[model samples]
Target: MLRFLDAGESHGRGLCAVLEGLPANFPVNIENINKELERRQKGYGRGGRMKIEKDSVEIISGLSEGKTTGAPMTLLIQNRDYENWRLKSQEETFVSIPRPGHADLTGEYKYATGNLRNSIERSSARETAIRTAVGAVCKEVLKELGVTIRSKVQTLYGLNDTFCDLFDDGLYDLIEKSPMRVLRHQEEFMALVDSAKKNGDSLGGWVYASCEGVMKGLGSFMHYDRRLDGILSGALMSIQGVKQVSIGNPFYIATGAMYHDGITYEDGKIVRTSNHAGGIEGGISNGEQLEVYCYMKPIPSLLLKLPSIDLKTRKNSDSRYERSDVTAVVPLSIVVEHVLAFELLKEILNTFSRDNKEELLAAIEVRKIRIGEIYEKTTDY
Candidate 1:
């Protein structure tokens, strides 16, 4: 039942979020949320905007003395760049040309607005800043439940540097030390980002996230919406520039018996030898690390514009140029991690059906004490 929504523009006054359904007595941390916001703006190939914005959250409601009040929580992130655009709102600004890869034209048509500024303002990935803020809170809640989440950039450009083990528990600290959040370092990746920046182009890459300490039976197979993988994939797909999602291997590199995991009984407990299914089976979590992989397409904003049609003149022209990153894969990995955190937090709450923080904690303790009960229900591999 945990749900939240974000509002505000890319360069608007500020970004805001209203989150509801959190139980009373759950401690809130503004500093942790700020730290997560800081991570979202860090990367190897970020733009000038990162330098301009220092995001911090102000809890407007539903928090009293650093604890939740079981009411709707409101968060505000003031836009540092809003001062430049504040005066321009009074005048009708029109972007004659629509960018090819952005929602410029489609959003205009859908919203019945002629100015593409309206589309670009809200459609910009900058809004994900607040979403990351929301996820930071969820991450804290998950931490209390003994669940941890993290993400890594698997590869940049055309490199297939899958050096780290997908389900490694010890990689989180190392990945945090990385500028790009990946295990392996390649000079070629850095060079590509620099070259792309100088040449007015952009690059994209793959990111993977893993969740540890999730108990079994968090999702249901009865309904499509209730399925864990479906919900996770949907949340991941909503990220900007993300083109595809994979639970395990997207190409299914395995053949024959290698495609599935082998289950065995060990010391009176059920154990999974391998996790080819990425921890979820039969639309529910199976008490293993839940892994999600995503492929992000290159950012559309480039100094070198592609061919586009002018909305006003009805003539072909180069797309509008904007200051943008050469590659967002680094900070994007953090975004993916936080999004995954929110999804897991919601699923845990919904599955546990707890109405308060004490109840939720007790329920988690119950699951931990009875982990073998779920495993005993299904003995087959």
Candidate 2:
């Protein structure tokens, strides 16, 4: 199975992720990985931590001369802000009251810990940095096989009408240029963010992600656990602050007949009139672009605190506030993109002959031929 285990606290020495199950001989570019890390750090409304930590991945193992050797890959990302936090110590940063909309309360209750700092450190979104590095590595592998994944912020604070389509031409460029990662309403988003900051509040939004060039039948319908949509949904929901996930525009109101895609043929290739199904059917990829949208909640650590009770003092108190983004939905697009990429890579590996890179590519080509033959025979009949 393709998987990774991540460790280290948000403000600890650094973060570490060990990823395994990739095939041998695939090339890796540290620079490309670092570029992805940099992308995750960008976006307006970010906190001072972003300015302090410059994320770059170091490969501790699994590659020989920039190529995979079929061993577990070890990735390390040093926290530049670690030294600053280290001097403060956990006692100094101890938390008595939990933050609202965060794991602090539940985690403290579950673990029976008095200090919420134990929960806060691990539950922080800062851990996504290492996960993003893993996703970047998966992206390189997927790129070699002609797959491309991308994502952008589709809405900010429930303002959806001004967003751009994910498949629009030059959408990526447009998102890169905008601080909010939206194709339109850049000024409005900035203004709202400024206002939220002034009011000591935070914002939430939707991130739309898509993967192109994934072949059909990557997942099996025979098993519920093996369904592609189920797997992808689980992965997306696992991200910090992500509360809702949909394969496509599931929220759109339509009749059963109008909601689904219509199959058609164009230029001797099968196509769909609409992609409302988001490129998946019956828990399997249907040779269409895989599209997903995730709704991330506002950052829990607000300058305007919520009501809570202090564990130490046994008295009513406001929730603890930490340094956090006014809105992280912009960089969240990057995280969503990479998270989907990693899941897709895992699905591809699970479905194909993946002992090595060459074998995996040949298997994919063969699967494509088989699909073509099946379609051709059915069309002829």
Candidate 3:
């Protein structure tokens, strides 16, 4: 079974991750992993920290000559910002009074610790940096198998643009170019972000992700746990601030019949006229592109402070301010992409059922042939 564990605190020296269960002889690229980390740090409405830190990963073990050795992969990302906090002594303790919406305050309570620092530190978004590094490694594996995952922001706050034509001619290019990493509609989006900052508030938005070249039958309908959609949803919801997830369109239209993708047959091939089900049905891939969307709630760390009780004094007081983004939905989108990529890669490995890279490819080719044969022989009853 493929599994991974991450370690490090928010203000610690760095984050570390260990990923095990990958097959041997898969190509690894350190530069690509660093690039993914860079992408996660980019994006508008980010806080001052992005300017201070340039994230990069160093492979400690389980790889040599740019290929995996079929052993546990260990990675490290040094925190350049750790110097800022190292001056404080252990005796000089600071208490947290403000609780973020999706953080581990409740967990701290269960442990009965006055110092919530450890709880919030481990629960921080800093952990996702390691996750992105691991996902970048998975992307390398997927690329070798002809599969790719990509994502983009779909909505900011209440403003949305679904009309593909209305999007900037250079929308995707702008996403690549802009620090905020948002697509077209930048002027408008930035205006809103500026407005939010002026109001001492924050906002959240939606992200759309897609995967291409994933084979059919990666998951099983016979068991609920084996459902691909369930796995994907769980992975995405794990990200902080991600409150809602959907495979496809979540809106209701005037006509009920218009909602679902209609099935069609052509030249001995089964196909859906539309992808309203997001390339999945009955917990399995349907030989179409996989689509997913995640909705992020606004970050709970507001510049306009709210009332709270100091953890040490147990007295009423205003919340403490930490360095946080006005809108983390942008970076959260990238984090969602990585989490989904990791889970999807696991599903791919499960489907192929091979520990070696070449063996997995051979199995996938055979499976594709079998799918073609099944489609050719089956007819509508």
Alpha carbon lDDT of each predicted model: 0.85, 0.89, 0.82
**Candidate 1, which segments miss by more than 4 Å at Cα?**
89-92, 165-171, 370-381
- The 10 consecutive residues of candidate 2 with the worst lDDT sum are 160-169
Residue 359 Cα positional deviation in candidate 1, in Å, after optimal superposition: 0.9
TM-score of every model? 0.94, 0.97, 0.94
Better of 2 and 3 by TM-score: 2
Model 3: lowest-lDDT 10 consecutive positions = 161-170
Residue-wise C-alpha lDDT for candidate 1, range 59-98, written one tens digit per residue: 8998899888888989999999988777774444558688
Q: Point to the candidate with the largest lDDT.
A: 2
lDDT of 3 by residue, 152-240 (tens): 77788987745231123465565657555555677788888899989988899888877888788878898999999998998898887
lDDT of 2 by residue, 255-356 (tens): 989988998767656789888898999999998889899999988888886899888888999877888999999888999888988999999999995879
* Model 1 alpha-carbon miss at residue 263, Å: 0.6
**lDDT comparison, 1 vs 2, better candidate:** 2
Error of 3 at 263 (Å): 2.3
Pairwise TM-score winner, candidates 1 and 2 = 2
Q: What number of backbone clashes does candidate 3 have, counting pairs of residues 3 or more apart or in separate chains? A: 3
Can you give the lDDT of residue 125 in candidate 3?
Answer: 83
Q: Rank the candidates by TM-score, best first.
A: 2, 1, 3
- Number of the top TM-score candidate: 2
